[model samples]
Target: MTERRIVSIWLPRLAIENWQRRNADWPEDLPLALATAGTHGQIVHDLNRAAMESGVSKMSRIVDMKTICPALKISDADHIGDTKWLARLALWARRWGPWSTPDGTDGLLIDTSGADHLFGGEPAMLIDIQDRFASAGCSTRLAIAPTRGAAWGLARFGSERAISKTDPLPYVAPLPVAALRLDPQTLLLLRRLGIRTISDLVAVPRLALMRRFGRANLAENPLLRLDQMLGRRPEPMASPEPPPRYLVETRLADPVMDPSDWLPGMIKDLCDQLAAQAQGCRQLRLSIFRVDGVGCDVTARTAAPTREAGHLLRLFDGKLENIDPGFGFDVFRLTAEAVEPLNAAQPGLDGEDTEGLALARLIDRLTARFGADAISRPLSYESHIPERSQILGAPVSDAPAPLARADRPLRLLTPPEEIRVLYAIPEGPPGAFIWRHQTLRVAKHAGPERIAPEWWHDRSGTRLRDYFRIEDPTGLRLWIYREGLIHDGRGAAPRWFLHGIFA
Candidate 1:
């Protein structure tokens, strides 16, 4: 197997760095500490180098840290949000490679393997990554090696060693066994046994090490890690996740409290950006983030895939008024949630447009006022049953479907209505029918049209139907059907049903 090169970017103060990004006025050298709830009380989760140097360290009690450093800065830790920020950075780092993952809340691991040459070489790439985080006010420790385990340890402890694949053992052996990423108890046990460094640990036989330490962990756990770090064992990584796009965001210079003050312009700005990125998308989401860390969001979908800013704004006009911006909001983001290909429109020479397009826009507005399910359209389906052949589809655009054409009633009873009938001839056309408490006499009529039940489905209770178009005395035409055949093998008697009436 080919050797792999992994780069570890460690942010020792990830939560503090995230907080600093939000508040730009924070001093670079200020002593800052972040705390999280513990069984006893708030405990320090992370701290800046300034705080660490001032005799306040991580895991120290919040009150104790404050007492130690009178002018220290402290805040509560948002671990989830901090991790998300780290993941986002890792996603953005994909310009280098396709494999990037979160190491922890405070770090990221990137497999730059064959991609380093694009930015010059491995050394240049390392310097570039360091410069980016440094410029962004993110304190970082970057190290690159042939394995993730070694890269991780080097980033935390090694000082820009620039070690090669063949020289790993020599450089790594001198560091304490903690660089091997062992449990504290194991490290303590090894220290008592006069094995404090990787060199001392490797001096013992692999079989003896396995037998001695196997009970605490896997039989080859320590040896396996050493092998993995030295590139002797294979360590496959998970595939990198793709970054989300069709999104645009704008942060305000000043927070806007009232909806009227900022919504329209912000919507127009973000919609224009979305139109560029999401040319054939149907659904879009708008996010309003307040300065106080609360967010309000809304979604809009077009009847067809469209990128028109005017049409999108029209859909959002009334809905934007409903969002309450408590205190004030400072950031606006728009993302295309869904999309599809759309055919180009071809109007008539006389400037007449297709009714389908106009109808779609009308449905778009109506659904914006109502909801998605409130507006529907007829979609043809391939089915033998008459009523089951067509379905109610969303107003979204799709390819047209072919349907069977036959002389049928304008309206149909869901289940054909049973009615009293008088036939002109036995086992023939209906002379008259009484339906819904009304008596009608046939003046003229059309002959029987036979339709059989679908054989593919259940045929137990189904029978052949003979339909007729009959005109009543008042000139009203009624569609009627007779179920069951006259001389078929079925034992049930023939019955009449009122199917529908023609306009």
Candidate 2:
């Protein structure tokens, strides 16, 4: 088994240097300190070399620091910006390792287990990392060890840049308690107990120390850190996983200007792969790479998830004509841009009736030829109003089942036209009404179906409707309604109108 190795990179002056790089006009010789809000007031968070030389140390009051160094430059520290840059740096450092992650706000941790040989050796790899960061105007201190804790301690506090594969206790024994990554309170407590260094703490009995500081959190416990640094405890690196891709390509021996014959076979190969993964394509794109370096592509979408090869072939029809295969094509790639799980469907116990599948295929073809918006079916909407009862939606979209009612007309008018009642019974549809500049006599008539306005949705003043199915002398049927009752306190006297027409 390959021995595990990790690298830790620290940037002590990250905030100061980031600010300097962004503002090129600022003099590098000036004493600059980044300040952040503290309990009392703004305090120095980080300082440059010049500020350090001028006695402007971290945690000092910015006002006092200004007095100590008359030319001191103070700016608000951008912790978020520093962290974002550190994350990007960690991702870019993958050239030296299989996995890397941002350790904190100003550092990175990389797992370079068996990859040091690519750079000749461990020392060579560290030197390469230093040179790369130096070229990018960044100051970095890096170290490698058998454990993450040891590498982290050495990068920030230890004297050496690389530790051998042997036990790391000797290298970290003399380091201060802070190297254990403990909280400020723990460090202070250790100091009062006269345990200033790792060696001093290790000399204390483990049972006695655990009794004094209950073993609750790792941040406050020192035993966990010691065990981790000595490789007794496991510390797994949290690396990001790459996104999944579904693509297939074909390289032709000879350049062909027309890909009509090759498209079917490539599509079949892609469909077979999708079936193996138990997924069906929702959208597919075909890319054509030309020998002269020009490229063209086209896309097709389905109404529902499907892996059928015949249906997909028809969808791409007339779409490839727009692709100008410039100077012949050398590559053909088929990729599924979007996919969804499609479990194997069980066939009916009796002989299969493909009526539903055939309808879905027809809808997909029509949608691909035109556009999804151009082909839609009526979807029942949850409303009591006749006009608001249904809406247009995707042909294959999921919707609530339509409401079942009686005596509905095939055609409906948007805004019912007002009719002059020539004759009619009291509190009912007009017997003989004038509509569209013509008079129609009622040969036979059905009853008054009362449809009240929805109280929650309709306005307070909205009136109820009394609908009736009436037939004329010419065998024409009409759906008419009275706008209001004779004396419903909400509105005026009842008015008649033509609402819909029956076939």
Candidate 3:
């Protein structure tokens, strides 16, 4: 097999170029720069040829940039939108090769080892790539060599539109040492040592270079990059990862009036297709398209990844009626929105679904009716404080079902109500109190159970509470508390409050 030849493309002004392509009638005389929020201050992220010619460069302070070019136009960076444009460009580049990966730093790497012949010759291929981008109104540079490292170096450093494969070390020897992609600190040290070019570094013995740089990091990256360009070390071209897509649509010959009869069968069919594409899908969205040209979506999510047809049908039950099919729904689409990998279930004899799995389906139905955040489940938290221990979270899992604590009330009030105490000691619990415009006498009372806040969590404004189980006249058990310890001589005088009621 022949060695793979890589082609590296550099679009140093991609951010501004993409903006110019999308928006027409941009001022040609004014300098443009894209700015993004930085730790120090708003810094110049990407500048155009006009901005650079005005002595404004990338990383230049926004303040100084205005001084250099008063008419300099700076705009917020739309990184995501720019990347999408690059993705479209990548699809266009794929006609030349099967594999292409985004360099993520204003460049793209394409494996064109055996693809040059498709365009007749190497020179023709380079011209075609240039012409394509030129037609799109974007300027670019291209280079090809035996190794990716060599192609990257030549593309960025060599003064040529394209450089054919040659002795890599000699070809890159005269290029600036920055072509090696070394960090700024390392490059500064090398410059201080009078090693300003690749040729100068090649003259220095490897053992001597190791003794100087190997101490900081055992793997000498500068030497390794040089070796890869010289074909001494292997550097493989990595392809871009494709995003996961899951969608299936089905059209019926006749619109259905009764959803229960037709929707179940259609849902089962869509689930089969979705299972084939992605079985480990956690969130699913079902879109119902009506004959009246109206559409509505019903979404459901499971605690864990699932793709069972029966479970999916049950989860989406009654959801089809929500679309209000006036003329009836003629099309149904099931899509996997959020996904996670899960082990394939072992095929077994047909039987009913497990009870444990049913909990997830129940939660799914509840979430479909009420919004996902509308419902919550309680769990026994690690905190000792009664209120803090009752941890409430969304109904997304069944591992921690709501468990009632006998010591704590089932329904806890958000803000404890202050009862008008008719009589009580100066530094003691309430003997009797006025509640709900009715005086209720205390039949019996439990001893004071003192509970303090988690000291590690908060050391400020946290007072210890003394709780008491008091029985009212109507046999109603009330959980009351007095704020702060009387003996500690800390905090305000004790106040009584009704926290919860235990029936």
Best by lDDT: 2
lDDT of 1 by residue, 1-503 (tens): 54578888888867877887787787867898888997789888888778988999888788998999988887888888887788677754555565788886788888888878977888898887777667556778888888877887788778763545655787677778777777777777878989877888789988998787666553236777787777888766664645335665665767787544454565566556555554565787776765544566688887677665667778876777667776676667666777665455568888976776677678788888888777666677766556677787745434243353556665678787898875456756666667888877888788688878887874676788888888877888777888887667675678888877677
Least well predicted 10-residue stretch by lDDT in candidate 1: 396-405
Residues 1-503 of candidate 3: C-alpha lDDT, one tens digit per residue: 76577888888778888788666688776799899888788999898788889999898789889998998998888899878777666644655565787776588888877779978777788787777677566678888887877788888888666564656776788888888777788888889989999999999999988787765641245777677778888877667744227666565768875455655666566566666665666777776655533456677777767777676677766665555767776656666777766555654366655675666777767776676777778777788677777677756544467567687678766788888888885545577898778787788788588888788986777888888888877898889888876656666667788888886
- Superposition TM-score, candidate 3 onto the true structure: 0.48
- Give Cα-based local distance difference scores for all models: 0.73, 0.81, 0.74
The TM-score-based order of candidates, best leading, equals 1, 2, 3
The numbered model that scores best in TM-score is 1
- Residue 501 C-alpha lDDT in model 2: 89
Q: What is the lDDT of residue 53 in candidate 3?
A: 90
Better of 2 and 3 by lDDT: 2
Give the lDDT ranking, best first.
2, 3, 1
Better of 1 and 2 by lDDT: 2
Record all residue pairs in model 2 with backbone atoms less than 3 Å apart, i.e. clashing.
none
Model 1 segments more than 4 A misplaced: 25-31, 161-163, 218-220, 240-385, 388-503
Give the per-residue lDDT of model 2 (tens digit) for 449-480: 88889989988999988888999989999999
